[model samples]
Target: MELNNKKVKELLPQKEPFRFVDYVDDVDKNNKTIQCNYTFKSDNPIFLGHFPQEPIVPGVLLIEAMAQSAILLMLCIGNEISLDGEKYLLSKVEEVRFNKPLFPNQKANIISKIERSIPHFYFFSSKVYNGFEDKILEGKFIVFKK
Candidate 1:
């Protein structure tokens, strides 16, 4: 189904600007995959501290955004599961690769797909890329709702 920008922001935990994801482009409830995007604005608070003369999106926040995307998708597809019963969290990240640097006001695209799922564990991989589809971040991640 198609998800708008506003709905995506609400699904994520962070507030604006600090909320790295901008929109949920699509999610296949059956396939267990989702696509999202984030536009780095100049006014983002992280920019002020991440760099001074030249600003860059901190790698750690980038990972957080990616993880958020994965959780959002799981929530969408795993409709039978209740989020409040336990907690949907990103439990692991492996083989993470950052291919490019993200500066202010750049568009970051994220694509996440669920690789496996059990009653308690959700495994997924997400890739963050620039507008041109050049990879900025890629990793295999999982979350345990417990």
Candidate 2:
């Protein structure tokens, strides 16, 4: 199904600097796969304090990105994953592995596939890749409907 990035942003509640996933570039319902890309811009608040000199996107945000990706996939399939105007609430996180670091201006390509989702209980496996095609992070995320 076709989705708008701007509308998707509205579905997400994280807002501005805190929300890392920028757009849902594409999605496949039959395959249960999604591809999205985001960039860490210099005009953000977190960078000012994250290092001031060697600024980079935090690892927590990377994991959050994976969770957000799973939420978006849910929305794409059902169009009602957002609860009472809220989009995501991470319930469980497992098998988290940080393979590399993410730096400013780098494009984060997040790909997620549903392990299972029925009702509010959802599980997904996700991976993050830099613009250069190197593996940056990977994890499994779980979310429940509120």
Candidate 3:
């Protein structure tokens, strides 16, 4: 199912200025993968201190974006695991590589595939791409649902 901004907001716990995911373009429950996107606004406060001269989206935010995408995919897997009354938290981030910097007003395409899942934790292999298809970042994220 495709999750638009409003639907995404309903599923995610984050609010504006903190929510990085703008929309989820695709979702594959069978494959446990999702494709999502986020557009950076020029007036984002992070730009103020991140370097007013050459502001860039922080790598941390990129990681959060990927996590959000992964969480969305997990929720779509089935109603059994949907977010009824639970919280998803970031547990670990491994082998994270930042290839390029994301600037204001630029959109990022995020693809997240679940590599594996434990009893309460899910590991995901994720990548962020620019409009040109160039990879901006790649990493493995572990999230704990509790």
Choose the strongest candidate by lDDT: 3
2 against 3, candidate with superior TM-score: 3
Model 2, 31-136: lDDT tens digits are: 8988887888877788899989989889988888887777778777775655465446899999989888899899999999998878868888999999999999
lDDT of 3 at 46: 85
Look at candidate 2 and give me any clashing residue pairs.
Answer: none
Off by over 4 Å in 1: 80-86
lDDT value for model 1: 0.80
Q: lDDT rank, highest first?
A: 3, 2, 1
Q: What ranges in model 3 sit over 4 Å off?
A: 80-82
Model 2 sits at a Cα RMSD from the real structure of: 2.1
Instruction: For candidate 1, report its TM-score.
Output: 0.87
- For candidate 1, the 10 contiguous residues with the lowest summed lDDT are 78-87
In candidate 2, which residue ranges exceed 4 Å CA deviation? 79-87
Best by TM-score: 3
Each model's RMSD to truth, in Å? 2.1, 2.1, 1.2
Residue 130 lDDT in model 1? 82
Worst 10 residues of 3 by lDDT: 74-83
